[model samples]
Target: MAWTTIIPATALHDLIGQGAPVLVLDCEFDLGDPARGRSVYRAGHIPGARYVHLDDDMSARPDGSNGRHPLPDPAALAARLRALGLHRGQQVVAYDGNGGFYAARLWWMLRWLGHEAVAVLDGGRQAWLAEGFVLESDDPAPVAEGDFTIAPALVGGVVSADEVLANIARGDLLVVDARDPARFAGAPHPLDTVSGHIPGARNRFLRDNFDATGKFKLPAELAREFAMVLGETPPDKAVMQCGSGVTACANALAMEIAGLKGAKLYPGSWSEWTSDPARPVATGQA
Candidate 1:
């Protein structure tokens, strides 16, 4: 079966042991210290897991207006995935120290690229450690060339900043900001110059999707929580965003796990939304 949403550490262990064709990725990252991702990956990671850099591999260089972590060119990102040994049919298990924050970005990207076999490691590295899985410090062996290519998206793709702006006036789309409550409340954030959110967007702190154990909440629980925010809007009518579009994917992932699929992502998110001074920004509670 394709592991589309999230996979437990024990399940991943069994999959690896079965010698299935898989690409395990370590997506641990720190927004403050960019190099720390690779540093920690080199220190220790899942055996045979390759490292994926958010800034270098998953995103394009920021051009002042394209947000902090702009989505990379699809073809370029496909080529990078191929280089990382992700083939058309291979299963991808992505993990991170952060509660699937960075890992879910890769999961969403793969789904957007039409690969349905990608999953984020539930509970991340801590779960793996708790399961008594030994991490390896040695460098992983080089992988053979992969034939992965981009296909039509299997999940909701992206919604542009223009669409989001128009939605503010249209009052048709549901915009959900996945940043923390404080950040969503227009608190000063070091990552972005602007402090507010899209005029009609609602705050849904991504961390709230998790339980006390750092694992995702059960599907039924997630459904009830999102129901309070969604009201009568269908999942397809919603757009998810965060400071720079990273954590937004986590919210999107949670929605999928809640069986509330089809919510599109605002790739530029708050960063891109705030780039233009002309765009309206709303501060305080929604």
Candidate 2:
């Protein structure tokens, strides 16, 4: 599948060990201080891993309050992929230092542009280290650029503020907030201007989707956990959100691993949603 959350370490190790035509990308990013992720990547990262800083590379300038993390131009992204030797049919593995904050973004973006052979590293680099996988500061082996084509983006996969505004009472579609407990509970948000969430949105911190070690829980484990919350709500109808739309992708990515489908992103999230006073805000817990 194009949107797998966890790939096997043994499989990756064997492929990497034998020098396969695979590319590994390190997507370490800290939302509190974006530059901090680059510093960590510079100090030492998974050997042969190319760093993709979230601010500088992954995210474009916020397009007003309605479009945070707007998709970068496909041609520009293709150029970067070419430099990284990510061509069509090439397997790409992405990982973040903690959980999959930024890695999931790259993975989903790649799939959005029609590249299917990409996945987020399970348990992240920490798990690899714990499993005795080798680490190196040197860059990865050079790869021959394959033919990667850019298809038109499926814009329907993205939810808009207008959609939320119009469908506040629609019971068929559910909006999921993937921020921390404090932020989701509207207790003085840390990043957004307002300290509230979208009315009718459900809270599921992105952190809950992972284990204490920052690795994703087993697929079965995740399925049971989400089932308790989702009940009979098919995952496909879920729309994910968070501050500025980063961690929400983590939740969206986890759903794919759990065999649920659709679950698109509300990229503007609370940051854009609350930028204007005209939008309705829901405060406090449900």
Candidate 3:
């Protein structure tokens, strides 16, 4: 079976040593300095791990309306993956410096493209380093290009700002924001010009999904925690969002790991929602 949601550091080490057909991607990124991720990768990274830039590879240029990190074009993403040596049935593991926030974005992107053999490294590079794994400064030689193709349809696991607005008006879908409490409460708008969350959206900070050591909490604990937020709403009817649709994937991944599937992502998120002057914004908690 494919490793779909999350993988541990030891398991990944074994996979690499055993020469398993796995593609390791270093997704370390600094939101303030976009170029810092590649530089960090150049200094040292996991053996045979290719670096994926959040802005260049994982997202498209913002058109001033599609939020800060718009989803990349499917065909372009497929080409990039093929160039990176991703192939059918190859397990892909992505990791970041900051927990699994950015890494989970790549995991969600692969699943959005209909590839199931992808996962985020739990606790990310921090976990690997803590486990005394070796790091390599040299970049891997390019491998033979693979024949990875984009799926015909986007299928599921995504929602647009329009859909969110419609849902809000209908009062049926439950929208969850994964940003910090202060940001969700409309104070200290650091990233975007907006200072609040979407009206009717509940705050569920992503960091709460992890433990003190930054590792994800046990599955049962996660399930119970999310159960509080979900209440009577079914998982399939819930939507997750964050500042720029980045960290929100962390919540989606956690939900899947907790066996609560079918929650969709709002890729346009608050960035896109606030770009318009007409959308309602809420503050001071849910």
TM-score of each: 0.98, 0.90, 0.97
Show where candidate 1 strays beyond 4 Å. Answer: none
lDDT of each: 0.92, 0.78, 0.90
lDDT of 2 by residue, 1-286 (tens): 3324567666678777888867889898877787888788777777678888776676677757655566667787887788777777678999977777788888877877767788888888777878888777665566666577787543228778888877787766688888887887778855778887888888888889888777777788888887776777788778888887778888888888887777878878888898889998987775
Off by over 4 Å in 2: 1-3, 139-146, 152-156
Alpha-carbon lDDT of model 1: 0.92
Single out the weakest 10-residue window by summed lDDT for candidate 1: 154-163
Scanning candidate 2 in windows of ten residues, the lowest lDDT window is 1-10
| lDDT tens digits by residue: candidate 3, 109-149 | 99888888898998999899999998999979889999888
Of the two candidates 1 and 2, the one with more favorable TM-score, higher being better, is 1
Model 1 C-alpha lDDT per residue in residues 1-286, reported as the tens digit of each score:
9899999999999988898887999999999999999999999999999999999999999998989999999999999999988889889999999899999999999999989899999999999999999899999899887999988997777889888888888988899999988888888989869898899899899999999999999999999999988889899888989989899999999999999999999989999889999999998988
Q: Is candidate 1 or candidate 3 better by lDDT?
A: 1
Tell me, by lDDT, which candidate is best. Answer: 1
Q: Which stretches of candidate 3 lie over 4 Å from their true place?
A: 152-155
Clashing residue pair totals per candidate (backbone < 3 A) = 0, 1, 0
